[model samples]
Target: MAQRAERTERTERADAQRNREAVLAAADALFAASSSPHGVSMDDIAAAAGVGKGTLFRRFGDRSGLIAAVITSRLEPLRRTVREVQEATGSAPRQQVADLLDTALTFKIDNRNLMSAAEDAGISSPYQAQHYGWWHETLRTALDRVPGVHAPEFTAHALLAAIRADLVAHLLDERKMSPEELRSSLAAHLDNVLGAA
Candidate 1:
């Protein structure tokens, strides 16, 4: 009976993992297709995932928690890449700063709508988010390695602000800047910020 119980526990864990993945995937698709994240309710996500609303709240706590989980799931791979680059020996700090901010800008452009939804869900300050803290620390560490930066902390914040979700949305949605154009502009802007070349 003990062995049977252990097997049952393993199966339960596997099912829970599957459910988690389904929820994240369903939420991702819905948020991506949504013009506004506010309209995509927990019930909608639960229906899409073939789960129940209770499960979503039990797993993710609330709307903000669920949104953060979805964003975190999407960012997992990007986080790995950022870590590898940040820890690499002999990586030029200025170029590292450029690469990091450019990647962030691209992500913000791609997920602007979902980000807006997050703000609507009461994640009002990006500065208050955990991921924002990680990016700020990581960028500041790289800035610390550069020659001329006097205040790595402030410089890191400034660089990150340049790629904020709202600004990216306005540039693309309002000003009609293509992703390529925005990227090119950011690159040049980074060059000035970090110095020539």
Candidate 2:
């Protein structure tokens, strides 16, 4: 009897893990495909995942928690890319800074819906995010290595501010700026901040 119970527990754990993955995948896909991620409801995610509403609440706490989880899972690869850029040997510090910011900006542009959903769910400030500190530290370290950078910390904050999710959305959606134009403007602004090498 005890052995059977142990097997059942193991099976239940495996099932729960599968459910979690299914929920994350469903939410990620739905948000990515939607024009307005905020329109996505927990019911929609639960239905798409083939899980019960109670399961979602039990696993992710609430809508915000679920969105946060989905975003975190999506960001894992980008975080790895940032680490690779930080460790690359041939790139100069200024170039590294540009690369990091560009990488993040690209992510924001691609995932603007997910980001907007996060903000609508009350996580509006990047500073409050768990990953924000990592980004700030990475950029600050790179900025510190640059020749003419006077304030690495503040400069890091300023550069990150330039690529913030809402700002990117406003530029692309409201202002109708092309992605190419935005990238060029960011490069030019970075040049101004970093000055001539």
Candidate 3:
């Protein structure tokens, strides 16, 4: 009897895990498809996931809460990449800075719309600020390794502002800078400003 109960518990756990993955995957697809994740209704998400509407709220609480979870799920990869870059020691500060810049650009390109939607959902949302804090801390860690850098936190904030999606999009779409040139110029600008190399 105990063995049977244990097997049942395992099955329940597996089902719950599968349900969570489906919800997150459906949310990701829906969020990407919609103009904003906030634009997607809970019912729409449930229909997309093939789950009942009640299940979604039971699982995620509300639209903003679900969006936050989805964004957090997506950010794991970027966080992992930052960790990998940091673990790779022996690069000069300039090289580290260059790698960080590339990472920042890639992250912005990947997550910009999703984050914007998150912002449109609510002002008190913790998603944007938390993400900025993560990136800023990652940059600060990399900057701290430099031999003679001053004000690593300030430098991190500066780099973030300079390479953020809004600024990059404006520079590319409005000012007509190609991505490669923007990257190169910004890298050089940081190198000059931060005295990295």
Q: What's the TM-score of every candidate structure?
A: 0.89, 0.93, 0.76
146: Cα error in model 3, Å:
2.9
Candidate 3 Cα lDDT to native: 0.74
Give the per-residue lDDT digits (tens) of candidate 1, residues 36-127: 65678999999999999999999999988999999888888999988887777566878888888888888888888777677667765778
Candidate 1 lands at a TM-score of 0.89
Superposition TM-score, candidate 3 onto the true structure: 0.76
lDDT of 3 by residue, 57-166 (tens): 88888877777788778889878877776676777766787788777876655555565566666736342566767878878887887777788888888887777555
Ranking, lDDT, top scorer first? 2, 1, 3
Residue ranges of candidate 3 with Cα displaced over 4 Å: 35-38, 123-130, 163-185
Best by the TM-score measure = 2
TM-score computed on alpha carbons, candidate 2: 0.93
Global lDDT of each model? 0.86, 0.87, 0.74
Report the number of clashing residue pairs per model. Answer: 0, 0, 0
lDDT, candidate 2, 1-197, per-residue tens: 99999999999999999999999999999988887867799999999999999999999999989998998898898888777756766898888988888887888889888887887788646688766777898889989999988899999999998987778888998999998899889999999888866
Weakest lDDT window of 10 consecutive positions for candidate 2: 123-132
Candidate number that wins on lDDT, 2 or 3: 2
Look at candidate 2 and tell me the lDDT of residue 78: 84
- Give candidate 3's error at residue 160 in angstroms: 2.0
How accurate locally is residue 80 in candidate 2, as Cα lDDT from 0 to 100? 85
